[model samples]
Target: MASYDLPRRLVAEAFGTATLVATVVGSGIMATSLTADTGLALLGNTLATGAMLVVLITVLGPVSGAHFNPAVSLVFAMSRSLPKRDFGGYVLAQTVGGVAGTIAAHLMFALPLLEVSTKVRTGGAQWFSEGLATFGLVAVILAGIRFEQKAVPWLVGLYITAAYWFTASTSFANPAVALARSLTDTFSGIRPIDLFGFWLAEISGAVAALLLFTWLLQPGTSSTLSSEAKL
Candidate 1:
């Protein structure tokens, strides 16, 4: 990941985000078309999304850390894992790529290039769910990096698979993703009006997780000293 240049990394971020959003929006459309039962439709959407995450993360993580979500990128930037200078570029790439993904999905399904989502998804419960979902996501990511770097893709994929069922908002925990979803009126879409609430909750939760995990994952002074003594 470190060996890649900034331009290459940015391209990877954009491409990865585009593919992720395409999978999300595309799967939703396919699922809804296949099933009348809401639960069955959601199940189909969830499986495709989770599976795509694993594939994208595994393939692109080495290029750009595969941060398709702005909230995840925010956490990495704050932690200095991703440079602050590149944060804006990352967000821009992700947002643009996400919208492109929505458009691509629409093209595949013979829908309009862009349609404002009308599905209502706002209010206190939904906001809280978004917050909790993002918090858990960031925590899982940081912990995976610390303890099991190779398993991050599966960890994220599985977590989101579970979150889709458990969360009221179906865990649309990424700000970039939320914005992209607003452009499509489909099974996965959230109303454009609801994006702000989701974004606020997601960013807040990500920062909160970063704060707690930074302290929690840090080595204690005593432990450091003891290790040095052994050395």
Candidate 2:
């Protein structure tokens, strides 16, 4: 339903992803600089990331569906909302954009250009948290698009804000984001060694959500039921 062509859509995906990650990494850096308390720093990071999602999705949804997350894109493709042919381009754009965002954040704070994160975010609990978080994210998107399309941006923003506190992995449900965060050694970073588990968890969660929600929101059954009731 998007009016933009492939090239424009790719640019929107790249630019939106870049800004989203920049907001995330930049805000985390600023939060750490200003606070000694981890709670307060996390609060700042959460608010900024949530706010950016609202803005980005609102502005770019029409052009590219505002899929800054590879998991989200994959789910869309699976649902046929996004063409399978375009899935690879979306993932590539999101990945490169996320990395660029991290670079931008580091340069803004005068930090090293690229530092492999040493933040060890491994273990079963963390991996499970990421899976659950990503599951909720995709579920929200599917339900919101079906029922409250206009409110999708706000729904996502609010969900992530809460997920940050509830999830152990801080809800880095996006594989592109997780990979980019590995380049930063700040409050939001995750070690590169821990990335595989995150990617697996997120993709699994997304696919599960897609299948479940598709069944729940069965388009054919709904209309058929309505017609039978009318008769």
Candidate 2 Cα deviation (angstroms), residue 48: 0.4
Q: How many pairs in model 2 have backbone atoms within 3 A of each other, for residues 3 or more apart or on separate chains, i.e. clashes?
A: 0
Q: What would the per-residue lDDT of candidate 1 be over residues 1-231, giving only the tens digit for each residue?
A: 789999999999999889999999999999999989999999999999999999999999999999999999999998899999999999999999999999999999999999999999999999999999999999999999999999999999999999999999999999999999999999999998899999999999999999999999987799889999999
Which portions of model 2 show Cα errors greater than 4 Å?
219-231
Give every collision pair in model 1. none
In model 1, the Cα lDDT at residue 117 comes to 95
- Superposed by TM-score, candidate 2 places the C-alpha of residue 9 at a distance from the truth, in angstroms, of 0.5
Instruction: Indicate the residue-level lDDT of 79 in model 2.
Output: 76
**Could you tell me how far off, in angstroms, the CA of residue 87 lies in candidate 2 after the best superposition?**
0.5
Q: Clash totals for all models, in order?
A: 0, 0
lDDT tens per residue, model 2, 156-200:
999999999999999999999999999999999999999999999
Give the per-residue Cα lDDT of candidate 1 at 201.
100
Query: Least accurate stretch of 10 residues (summed lDDT) in model 2?
Result: 215-224
